[model samples]
Target: MSGNRAAIRYAKAILQEANEANAGDIVFDDMRSVQATIRGSKELRVMLKSPVIKAEDKRQALLSIFGDQSKYTHSLINVLVGNKRIDMLSGVTESYISLYNEAKGIKEAIVTTAVALSSELEVQVLEKVKEITGSTNVTLKNDVDASIIGGFILRVGDLQYNASIANKLGNIKREFSKSL
Candidate 1:
């Protein structure tokens, strides 16, 4: 828990520096790519979490992978490596992406349903999300979960609407059990 908090703080600091440098967008893209790379590579993730490796070695390895990234990214890696907090790299990058989105007035909504959303449904969801959040710069992600049975679940930041059939059924069962 504390680690995540520290990661978030680091993320915010870097984001502020990126904005001050007038390279927020470029750094945002770099962080997105870094997040994608870390999430995609099992070996890299393992290596990052391993305490056996020297911080300098890990730093050099990351530098090689993200050679083309912006100066802020390079500095971030430097700070993490110097502080021996390289294990927090992924968490920090993810937090940074979230901060970047919030800074740009972009809200991410995650929709889960029994099946993939049709184009029309997706548009409708986006419209509903905009109405709820009052943010026009909304990004939607659709996740399919058959166990939800039907309907959809919508999440925007810390707010969630669990309108799934499974959830409704559970609520009904709970209400009936309580009446007994």
Candidate 2:
């Protein structure tokens, strides 16, 4: 199976276990911390993925890092090490985020503009998107593209609303060509 699928499966299992243990919130926080750790440390990732290291060594290392922090997290790390699936750590973290978002009913949106938007404009746009999507929680990622010249593009998951000058030009060009 793909790494993402495996990670998602592992995350689901971990979530189930956390619920059973009455430590769901703790597990979520631990997963977030682990994700941050993986993102911040390339050496740590290499060490975790190294076949030369024994599972016990990996577990000990995880324990040293997160042992006292949260028992559920420590146990989860040990389980990953025992399974020799450290390479999926990043994916697992992402999966956990997705699960968390689902639980919280949050949606992420990306908005790209030719220029930076004012704080008020940004808030207005976010509010509009939240209203349109009916999402209680919305996270926005902004991108600036000078080539766009003007207007903005809003992307909500697989759907995109493009109102950029570049797209307008392309549309006009297409229409002109068809008329030729």
Candidate 3:
């Protein structure tokens, strides 16, 4: 939507600014922290999206949470608040991470399994993702979801390979219903 497009625009602008200052990596770290902090706190999320709160208060809250950011990051806060788009902070951070990874030529693969992946399994998954993406710079994130029961789901960019037991069971149930 428009909001996402705007977030991407803001992310691109900030990335360019950071790169010009040779602080892209530092800003990338700041964005990751911002994303994690925003994702972890419901109150923060609510405040960002709340129209009842004044822009100054929201800026103060964000500054308090991420006061140690780089100059570019602090400038970003001011710009977003000035534009009255502080509510898009989370989206902006998420877009910034995606843009940063793409700029760095790093592909992120997410693997969801019933339990945490062992070291060997993680290595194997990493190798598989590298092969699939044809990129040596690949990062793997392992997520544990008990509902999957067994097997794993691998996601790289827009590609998703769902081999979870839950999916198989659902397919089987669909087939039975179709036959009847």
Candidate 4:
């Protein structure tokens, strides 16, 4: 069907196979490596997506690349290739990552500041987030935006906490316009 749907199906298939083989962690690592390989090599991606390439040839290539590392992963790649779903490789890998994260209860947080945060500040922010979300674990990605002037913005999942000076100023400006 659709690329995303196919990708989700393949991801589930891979996860199920991994679980059955009692190598779920190993398969996850292998999937990460596979995703990196596809992202790093344009030629490899082209080969994987090429309609002219035979399924057997694709399977051989995938086996050569990942067999020693992870036989289960190799088989998963082969199945995708055989089904003419190689183009969904990236999406599949992403879906697998999402699934893995959900299984692990890992939360991703994005924190943006006008200036680079010191280690102490970072720790403080992380601790505050943990307290607020009651999340035992947090993956914090940091970004610096000079346009923000000062303060920070924290985004955890679908929720955003914007304390940036730019946002505050914009809000004040809106209030002034309304009053006028």
RMSD of every prediction: 3.3, 5.3, 2.6, 5.4
* 2 against 3, candidate with superior lDDT: 3
Name the lDDT of candidate 4.
0.81
Write down the TM-score of every candidate.
0.78, 0.65, 0.86, 0.64
What is the total number of backbone clashes in candidate 3? 0
Residue-wise lDDT of candidate 1 within 1-180, one digit each (tens)?
113898999999998998988999999999889988998799999999998988889999999999999989999999999998989998998889888888788998989999999999899999989998998899897888999999999988988899999999999999999999
Q: What does candidate 2's lDDT look like per residue over 57-166, in tens digits?
A: 87788788766557767666777877888667778877876686667676877799998888899999999999999986997757788998899999886789999999
- Write one digit per residue (lDDT tens) for candidate 3, span 1-180: 113999999999999999998999999999988988887799999999999999999888888888998888888998999999999998998889888888898998889999999999899989988988899999887889999999999988888899999999999999999999
Q: How many backbone clashes does candidate 1 have?
A: 0
Best by TM-score: 3
- Name the 10 consecutive residues with the lowest summed lDDT in model 2: 67-76
Q: Using TM-score as the measure, what is the rank order of every candidate, best first?
A: 3, 1, 2, 4
Q: Candidates' lDDT values, in order? A: 0.91, 0.80, 0.91, 0.81
lDDT of 3 at 104: 90
Clashing pairs counted in every model: 0, 0, 0, 0
